[model samples]
Target chain A: MLLVILELVGIAVFAASGALAAVRARLDVFGVTVLALATALGGGVIRDVLLGVHPPTSLTKWPYLLVPALTGLLVFSFHPQVARLRRAVQLLDAIGLGLFVTGGTSTALALGAPPYTACLIGMTTGIGGGAMRDVLLREIPLVLRREIYAVAALLGCLVVAGGSVLGLPEGPVALAGSALVVAVRLLALWRRWNAPVAHGLDA
Target chain B: MLLVILELVGIAVFAASGALAAVRARLDVFGVTVLALATALGGGVIRDVLLGVHPPTSLTKWPYLLVPALTGLLVFSFHPQVARLRRAVQLLDAIGLGLFVTGGTSTALALGAPPYTACLIGMTTGIGGGAMRDVLLREIPLVLRREIYAVAALLGCLVVAGGSVLGLPEGPVALAGSALVVAVRLLALWRRWNAPVAHGLDA
Candidate 1:
């Protein structure tokens, strides 16, 4: 129950972010909706596909579709007010990041991925949606360029994978892992810490 | 036997296009390799994933991995001369588009996707790699803006799907579909034909 809720929240936040980005880019209503759907659902779809799950929830379920679709439309309709709440959105995004990474890791484990591969897939799940949104917007992916986003997800995934490997119960370990990711992401944002750029050739 | 050969040729051409784009973007060798791999293998990976196939051929098969990796390196090493072969590459790309669309549709059909769904997936498979490359390169997806790329793929897929629905043989249907895609793509290029631009709002 809790996991389902968390997933919905994550999808809604991601959808809002994508819708806002489309608005910022001066996209039309259709564009906003498409970008939002891609941003909210792209990661999970990729993860499910990798795990060999057919007709992923993103494609088949009602709540999963409705939440993101509503969020995107709402964001599009009230973009000015939504944009003003940037800090709040960032905080929600941090929370979303936490939930998605932990959820992704657990799901990969459930699907019988090797621990290390699960860790990688978890990170991919966390970043995939935003990457799609950015790409469609004709921007270099923020995950590849932004501050500590993927690193935070990777670290969280590692913790989950490690716990799973050690025979720890999944529920508590996932909660702890998500908390850690949220903490690290928030702290990074608060401190303005970023991984060092890889010299002039990184681009 | 013939299908395997055609698939390899398509992958090589897509890889070369990606690597050439990377070079044109002034990306480093690593970036060139990554882009090339994504372009060559991305579509198939997506198609396989949607079909609930695990550890997609791109991840597990040696030939699938090697051809694109080598293509990227070779292109990076001899970009200037290769870039000069633009016309030849375009012709190859048209052939690749044909193969991918036909292959994708067939695979989807085999996996039990509905005829229309298979058609859409086929078009997706034909364009997904180039979309990834263009996105990574921070350019608008060429398929979304340029000549009749997606349209040609869609039309080809429709032929394949229509044939299947009519209980036609798969082999000849696919061959005919692929030929149609290639012909349309090449004719569009040769005749300087393009879809009319949406006024102002397409961006």
Candidate 2:
């Protein structure tokens, strides 16, 4: 039940981010909806596909699809108000990242994927949607640029994988992993932390 | 046997286009290689995943992985010379698009997908890699922007699905479908045919 709530919240927050990006790009309504759906569900769909799960749950489940659509509509209608709360949106995005990374890692492990693959998929799941959103908006992905986003995801994955290896209970392990990601991401934001750029390539 | 050859050819041509795009973006060698691999195998991998095939043949098969890597290296070293034959490269890209579309549609049909779903998957397979390449390079996807590219792919998919519905032999059906796509795409190029953009949004 908690996981389900987390999943919905993550989808809503991610969808909002996507809708904001679309507004920034001055996209039409259709474009806004497409970006919202892609941002909220693209990562999970990719992960499910990688795990050989057909008809990705996001596509088949009504709530998963509806949440993003509604979120997009809401954002489209009230973007000016939403834009003023950008800091809150960023915090929500960080929380979404944590939720998604933990959920992805646990799901991959349950499906019998190797630990390394699970970790990779977890990180991908946490970052893939935003990357797709940025790509569609014709911007370099933020995960590949500023902040410790991918690193935080990687840490979450590591925590989950390590806990599984140590025979930890699934519930506690997932909670710990998610908390770690959220904490790290929040700290990074608080400190204005940025990933190091390649030497001589900082322009 | 025929499919294998066609797949390799498609990968090579797609990788070449990706490499050229990376060059145009002034990306480093690592970026070029990454783009090449993504462009060459991204579509097929997405198709396989959607079909419930795990690990994707491209990742498991040595030759499949090697072909794109080698293509990237070759382009990185000889791009100036290769860039001179722009017309030839464009022709090869058309061939690759046709091959991938027919191949993807047939594969989806063989997997027992409905005709509509198969056609959608086929079009996705034909354009997914190039879209990913463009996204990675921070450009709007060409398929979504200009030309009769996606239309050509959709037509190929329709031909394949229609042939399957008629219970035609797979080999002949695939051949005819691919040939149609290549012919249409080449003609579009020669005639400078482009999909109409929304008025007042052409920038």
Per-model C-alpha lDDT, please? 0.86, 0.86
Q: Label model 2 with its docking quality class.
A: incorrect
lDDT of 2 by residue, A75-180 (tens): 9999999999988998899889988999999898998876766876787788889988988787866764556776789899999989989899988988898889
Residue ranges of candidate 1 with Cα displaced over 4 Å: A52-57, A60-66, A196-203, B1-45, B52-109, B114-123, B126-130, B142-203
True contacts kept of each: 0.26, 0.29
Q: Which runs of model 2 end up more than 4 angstroms from their true locations? A: A1-45, A52-110, A114-123, A126-130, A142-203, B49-62, B195-203
Give per-residue lDDT, candidate 2, residue B108: 94
Residue A160 error, candidate 1, Å: 2.1
lDDT score, candidate 2, position A148: 75
lDDT of 1 by residue, B1-203 (tens): 99999999999999999999999899999999999999999999877777777777679979998999999999999998998998999999999999999999998888888786687678778988998888878886677555677678978999999999999999999999999999998999999887542133333
**Ten contiguous residues with the weakest lDDT in model 1 chain B:** B194-203
